[model samples]
Target: MRGLWRAHRWTVASGALLGLSGALLAVWGNPVNTGICISCFLENAAGALGLHGNPRMQYIRPELLGFFLGSAAAAVLAREFRARARGPGLHLLGLGFLMAVGSAVFIGCPVKAMLRLAGGDLTAVAGAVGLVAGVRLGIALLGRGELGLGGPERPAPVLVPAGVVVAVAVLAGLAFVPGALIESRTGGGAQHAPAAVSLVAGLVLGAACQRTRFCITGAVRDAFLLRAAAPAAAVVAVVAAAVLVNAFTGSFSVGYYDQPGAHLQWAWSALGMGLVGLVAVIAGGCPFRQIIRAGEGDLDAATVCVGMVLGAALVQSWGLGGTTAGVPPAGRVAVLLGLAGVLGLALTRKERIA
Candidate 1:
């Protein structure tokens, strides 16, 4: 197994691990079809930090903390740990905000979209389609050599931010330290596997992804632009494994109606994910990848993380997120506005020489 990983079979191995982890998370306790949603987990993390007053979503999910620590450990061991600056700061912040907004509008990011589909929510098909379309739009701009961030830092200083993240994780874990923090009493917030299990799963995933440089955005982008199949194949493997596991464990439910944490508005799902796809392309990674990047000491990725938390708060406070009935009018408007913002950025940003 170690030899396979060393030889660059990281994709298949990590994909299988992700699939198994999702299935186990579902069996262990997470909202149905939402074993490990990057957006949802971030919102939950925000709520845990008292960033918002959403009781139902407030809890310190160890999975998120594990992603950071696990990746950091792997990077350090591999001698790949380095801190880098991301430029066009204000623009990157805006793009991150829009990315979160879009994800909230749909109640899922790319990972959740795929997981939802694996669990038999046919509505996710719309989201998947939108994701593809959005990626294609970004590709069009890339073809013109627009929307690039500047070069990497020469002397990378990674430890400081990594230490900060570790501190935050420790504080987050204090939720279990006997009344040190508020916790969700019911619903999705109430559901979770043991902290140890979730954290370990996250750590394994983080390490594998870091080693392989895995990014869902990169997967789609490479598949379309470079005709690369490895990343895309990894995605397929995950989906297949998730589907199989869910079916075997009776976690899979066919059809779309009354799916937990999901609305049936087809157009909103498509449009919301489309917005996510655009911003993810602009930001250079999906939500989870951004988190991993932050763990690796990219300050800009940290900026995006903050934006995502703010976006979650904004949606919840303004009632712009989807509910069981359907997508809210406010969410619909947000998606449209987000797309417009992305378009403006794409046109105005100077082309970067990579």
Candidate 2:
């Protein structure tokens, strides 16, 4: 496995495969253009658990479970399962929550934003611009000695895997059970890809990403700031593969204002992802990275995941998220708050890595 990852072609090919497979899965299923959105899936899971009563967006996504489990397996096998934390736990939790809210406002994470664009959602282009702008801003902050939140202290050996096991068990139970809290009968909320397929996709993507260190934000950031082309090349590979698959499957539609499950407002889309880019950089990785880190026993990443789940619930409960029309007022406010939070962190921190 290590030998394969050391080969650049293998790593890029695996990433492209993960992206293509995930996109194909979404098209085959009824998740619209979204193949495997970390934030959206987490939000759906939160709604499925009755965290919020958003009927159209409730379901336990199997992909998420596969992600953690796959990453865990890789970590264990690779001897990379180091349990460690660095900074304040609660603050990271707050940042994660804000990041989730911002992502919800845009209706996608960095990965989904790219997928959305590849599927011909013009609004995703705005979000992509915002994401790059945010990352650029973050880089500037780093130049100014702006430090962000660190990790938490490592815990006992049993705690990390035990936590992951508990999370997996809960997700598995939700996948099988169908009660009022589970929302299995609803057409929209209960809709899901076949559990087996979702799990397999997640497992493959997670393991490959763990080996190759694939990150959407890092891809763009490296290209724009560091003058590196490798990360960006991987992103282009995924985008090309996904676009081809989506076109072949009749899933490619062009337009910004009326994409399925996406809003048309260009401003908010950009700002929402701008917030995500800033916060993610401050947090030391994108949402995907955070998930993998959580699997590797980073409690801070776990806290961020919790924040995403809670933020999903809050967005639904407060009507702060969007459907197809546009972002709610509260959702806009959430994005602003995210921007403020990240800026505050950037300004206040003492150490500068850039």
Candidate 3:
């Protein structure tokens, strides 16, 4: 098992498998235009709690529950489940919130941005460019020794699993007993793929991602900064696999502007992801990495994940998120605030460069 894990081919293959499976799951009826989005799922879950009233997007997503649990299981099995913290709490939470807000403005995270592109959303191209720009900026900050918040000292071993259990219970309850507060009757909001299928897919993908350490931000960062092609290669494999599946499933549409559930504003899309990329670099991992780390018992990552969920809720509730028609007023303001925050973090940090 160790030998197989150490092999580069195995890692790449697993990443490809994860990407293909996630895309297929989306095509199979997970959510139209949102097969596997952590941010989107969190937003949906928040709406399920009556945090927001967007009826078409409210539901308890099984995939998210599967992510934490799958990661926990893998960590335990691999003997790598060590609870730890590295940076400050409040700062991490703030960054996580900003990341979520930025992502909402663009309507996806770095992973979903790639998926959106593969699904023929041209707006994602701009988002991709933004991601690259943000990563580059982060690299520059790192060169100057500009680091953001640090975490707590002690780590709680049970927090992750406990959280997962609670989430699962919530989802199960919602699935079985319809609540008046829960928006289960909205058009795009109330729809969901089969719970069994979504759970299975999340499990598979989570385990695969945990094993391979797949991260979109890290892939781009390593490629540009370290000149290493391995992580980038993994991304290529996933993209290729997803594109193939999308084509096979007749989910492929080619264009930047006319894709489903996407707006044509190129600049904002780019800026939105750029903000995410920058903060992710400062945070020490991409959003996907954070999810995987939370599985491995990293409390800081878990905090970030929590912040992301809250941020999603705040964005949707305040009308700060984007839609297919265009960027919302609140979303625009959130983007501006995010950009300002990043710049402030960069400028205010006192670091000693070698």
Clashes of each: 0, 5, 10
Residue 176 miss distance in model 2 (angstroms): 2.9
Write the residue-wise lDDT of candidate 3 on 3-88 in tens digits: 43345566678668766876887777765557777778888878887777777778877777677667767878898778777777
Candidate lDDT (C-alpha), each: 0.78, 0.76, 0.77
Q: State residue 72's C-alpha deviation in candidate 1, in Å.
A: 0.7
Query: Candidates 1 and 3: which is better by lDDT?
Result: 1
Model 2 scores a C-alpha lDDT of 0.76
Q: Give the candidates in order of lDDT, highest first.
A: 1, 3, 2
Q: Which digits, one per residue and each the tens of the lDDT, describe model 2 over residues 216-287?
A: 777677767756566577777777788888898888888866787788887998898888888777777788
User: Candidate 3 — which pairs collide?
Assistant: 56-188, 56-189, 57-189, 86-151, 87-150, 87-151, 88-150, 88-151, 122-256, 320-331
Candidate with the greatest TM-score versus the true structure: 1
Clashing pairs in 2: 85-151, 85-152, 86-151, 86-152, 87-151
lDDT of 1 at 334: 88
- Model 2 residue runs over 4 Å out of place are 1-11, 151-158, 178-181, 350-354
TM-score-wise, the better of 1 and 3 is 1
Off by over 4 Å in 3: 1-8, 149-183
How well does model 3 score by local distance difference test? 0.77
* RMSD, every candidate, angstroms: 2.9, 3.0, 3.0
